[model samples]
Target chain A: DQQVKQNSPSLSVQEGRISILNCDYTNSMFDYFLWYKKYPAEGPTFLISISSIKDKNEDGRFTVFLNKSAKHLSLHIVPSQPGDSAVYFCAALVTDSWGKFQFGAGTQVVVTP
Target chain B: NAGVTQTPKFRILKIGQSMTLQCAQDMNHNYMYWYRQDPGMGLKLIYYSVGAGITDKGEVPNGYNVSRSTTEDFPLRLELAAPSQTSVYFCASSSSEAGNTEAFFGQGTRLTVV
Candidate 1:
């Protein structure tokens, strides 16, 4: 079973616009979420994260919003830059499982100039 | 900074053969992990260690063994390789004190079994 899921396989946005990536989780035990950006031939790099206690968390141009009632979370990049293009993965914390992580299939975000 | 180094960047093994993948991190993070990723699927944890001499199984721990003798190194051993084990393996480390923080991943080691 896929506890964490990013239904969208890919997304494309024009530079200077906003890019939104969404994720959902089936396990209610997950109380924290994280976003990672990956490029070809390199390991994934952490972007932003949010906790169940907070509805939103922001870091520079990146922001993460969570809705417990909907079991969903999203990452938004305002005034997206072409350099932001990469595969974005959403992950959830499985605390009961020794802090093991459950990741979504990931969405390829394309920020076109 | 050589955050996480995984040796033998690429390897090929025959079915039933055995091998070991080495991973070392300089960050001195308390948490280390091993994960595998396949096409169309996200990352799956194989094993992890909270500190030296302590290890735990992850979501996909079958057919694999791990040893953590020191905080800087965590090696994964494949006793008997299988075709299903052919995939990219990654090693990561994190400092949980940083609010259940982010993990730094290795460049990844691609393994193929015939």
Candidate 2:
């Protein structure tokens, strides 16, 4: 069974707009949530992460919001740029689980200029 | 710095063939993992090691094996290649120390089993 899920398989956004990608997880034990961006034929790179203790975390143009009560998390990109076009994956992990991450089906984001 | 390195960016194998996927990291991370990504599916963990000589199976361990002989190297072995084992394989490493939660991944190896 897939513990993490990204309901949207793909999203298209205009440049300079806000892009939101959402994820839901069934496991309540997960306390660390992260987002990764992947370009074609490349490995996924870490974008941002949020700890369960905090509701939101931000870095530059990217922000991750976690709603532990709802078992949902969302990643937002402000002023989305064409360079941000890639597949974004949501992952969660329990700190004690040997750092094994449970990944969600990635959401492909296309930023149109 | 080479965060993580995987050998043979691509490979093709006939049925019943066996091969080892090589992975190395220079970050000295104690945790290493092998994961497979299928078309339109999320990455599923195959095996992982917390330190040298300590390996454990993850969600998907069938037809796969792994060994961690050193902090920098983790190799995955496929005993008998099957069509179902065809997928993109990724090797990642992370430190279990406090405040280091992110994992560094290699470019990945695309494997095709005939």
Interface RMSD of each: 1.4, 0.4
Which lDDT values do the candidates have, in the order given?
Answer: 0.91, 0.96
Model 2, C-alpha of B44: deviation from truth (Å):
0.3
Model 1 chain A lowest lDDT segment of ten: A93-102
Sliding window of 10 residues with minimal summed lDDT for model 2 chain B: B96-105
Q: Residues B1-114, candidate 1: write the lDDT tens digits.
A: 889999889999999999999999998887999999887789999999999999999889999999999999999999889999999999999875747567889988999999
lDDT of 2 by residue, B24-107 (tens): 999989999999999999999999999999999999999999988899999999999999999999999999998798998999
Clashing pairs in 2: none
Fnat of model 1, as a fraction: 0.60
User: After best superposition, candidate 1 residue A81: deviation in angstroms?
Assistant: 1.9
Instruction: List per-candidate RMSD values in Å.
Output: 1.5, 0.6
Can you tell me the CAPRI class of model 2? high
Alpha-carbon runs more than 4 Å astray in model 1 = A94-97, B98-100
Worst 10 residues of 1 chain B by lDDT: B94-103
DockQ, cand. 2 = 0.90
Q: Which stretches in model 2 have alpha-carbon errors above 4 Å?
A: none
